[model samples]
Target chain A: MKQENRQRLAGAAAGLVNGLFGGGGGTVLLPVLTRELEGRHAFAVCVAAMLPMCAVSAAAGMWNAPPDLWQAAPCLAGGLLGGILGGLTFGRVPVGLLRKAAGAFMVYGGVRYLL
Target chain B: MKEAILTFLCALVAGTLSAWGVGGGTLLLLALTLLLDVEQRQAQTLNLLFFLPAAGAALFFHRRNGELDTAAVRRTAIPGALAALVGAGAAMLLDVDLLRRPFGLFLLYAGGTLLFSRGKGFSNQRGEEAPPTKKTQ
Candidate 1:
């Protein structure tokens, strides 16, 4: 398959997952982008690509139920702050260990949900 | 009041992780539902919104650095949008309890994969997850 086709497929897969799950599309999109482009650009491109996709999905996800802005306020506050920190720290942080830790916790979290 | 603070703290941590590309949105969703007593679907929706500002902030730096590829975004975003509609509808229709199990299994799969995969940098351009034999086109 063409790389473009593969990328589009990745995009669709990512969109579906994020919309259904309410997040996680970037994970689906990243690996494909990494292969298609250089690592730095791939991450940036994936981020850019996800914005619009998430916008559409978020809008849909919120249709049946809207969050109270009061509840959303603090979370958004933290999220915005974290985003700035992470963005600045991007290549600077040693994410390999962090990713592992998060993955381990996610595994634990997943099991907890399961049982 | 306490819950608000807790939610902010959790979102802060999750946001950083996600901004670093570690899939922290999943963590925030779980934290909200299990730890803070938020509804699952609501948590999910919140997670989606949570990503926007975080990603937007990151995009600014990336764009300044000339790291973005507009052509690629064009290729991917359209199909992604259409598929998102299908996924979003299904998510809303399902009860949170029923949704929990499938979502759980997915989490397990993704987390396990992340845990087991070879360690690599966040940017990925540093040389990993690429084919040893294949060349970039």
Candidate 2:
């Protein structure tokens, strides 16, 4: 497929997934984009493109309902800590190891979902 | 090429799963590393970036449906966003390969848990087969 066509299709797919499921589509989308594009740039572009959609989906979830501030505080704090730590720690780690870990996680998650 | 199409298709699936609260980031990482031949760090970083917007949209949708706990957002997102920024910066500096092994392991564990726990009350929604509990009992 042409670049423009591929881009268009990808966008359409992202929108459809976001609209239907809220925010689950990108997990699948990223891999598809990487495989199809055959390059980090394409993968990066796909990730960049989905940013707006992700924001929109999250906003959709938060639009009407208000979380209990107290209850969420810890989670938010933890998420923040986790993000920072994960980001930083990941860098020091071996890429091969991470890939293996990812594969393992998928197997586990897939099994969990299926079973 | 075959590679390009495959990556695009994978992202498409990842996006859908993200909506249901299964973080698309991890899935993206898996796809990139296992299928697309992308570097593990690249995949991990990309996964983080991809998830931001999807997560944002889901939060918005939940808000519209009265599912978002605003108080939670204030406490969690505020901190989480800040941490994400720091994390992103750190991710920029680290060796891409270092994190791949554990990340893979994590996916394995999570996927396994989900599969094994099927038909259980662990999920937020109670299954039909679950026996009814009696307040009277």
Candidate 3:
């Protein structure tokens, strides 16, 4: 497949995941982009692309959300701080460790939902 | 108070994951749905909202480090954005329970891939030798 076609497909896939699930587009994009781009570069592109995708998806689906501002506020606040921290520590932490942690979290989430 | 604390902590974890350039929203969704007993639809909604700031922050850092490819961004953003709207509409129409089971299975699949694969996809932070590059025609 042509490079342009590949990028478009990756983008569409990323967008679909983002809009459908409300997030996780980057995870989907990372592998696809990695085939054409460098590892960090692929990640960067995924991150940048995700911003607009998330925004559009969120706006489209905002009406579906239950009115629960009080419940959401704390999580949002904590997430902001966590983002800042994660940004600050981005390349500082060991990638292996982070990957394991993320994997563990995903496994736990999947099992929890399954049961 | 306890609920508030848990919410904050979960969001923090979610944010950190987002910053790592993975899907922090999945973790956030899991936290909200399982830990907080939030309805599946509501948790998904909150995950989308939470994604914005976290992604913005992560992008800022990635940009500062000169990691983002502007040309690629331009090519992908519009198509991706349009598709996202369609996807969101589809999700809104789907039954919540139906969505949940498949979503869980997906998470498991994704997690298993992450755990077992030796793919160099997520090792961005390590200063190890870069993976062999493929020349794009």
Best by lDDT: 1
**Local accuracy of candidate 1 as per-residue lDDT tens digits, B46-95:** 88888788788878877887777787887888888888888888887877
Name the regions of candidate 2 deviating beyond 4 angstroms: A1-105, A108-115, B118-137
> Candidate 1: where are CA atoms >4 Å away?
B120-137
Error of 1 at A91 (Å): 0.2
Q: Per-residue lDDT of A10-86 in model 2, one digit per residue for the tens?
A: 55554444432333234334443433332222223343455555454444334322333432233233333333333
Give the chain A TM-score for each candidate. 0.90, 0.58, 0.81
Compared with the true structure, the alpha-carbon lDDT of candidate 3 equals: 0.75
Error of 1 at A79 (Å): 1.5
Against the true structure, candidate 3 reaches a TM-score of: 0.90
How close to the true structure is residue B112 of candidate 3, measured as C-alpha lDDT? 69
Q: What fraction of the reference interface contacts is present in each model, in order? A: 0.68, 0.06, 0.66
Measured by TM-score, the strongest candidate is 1
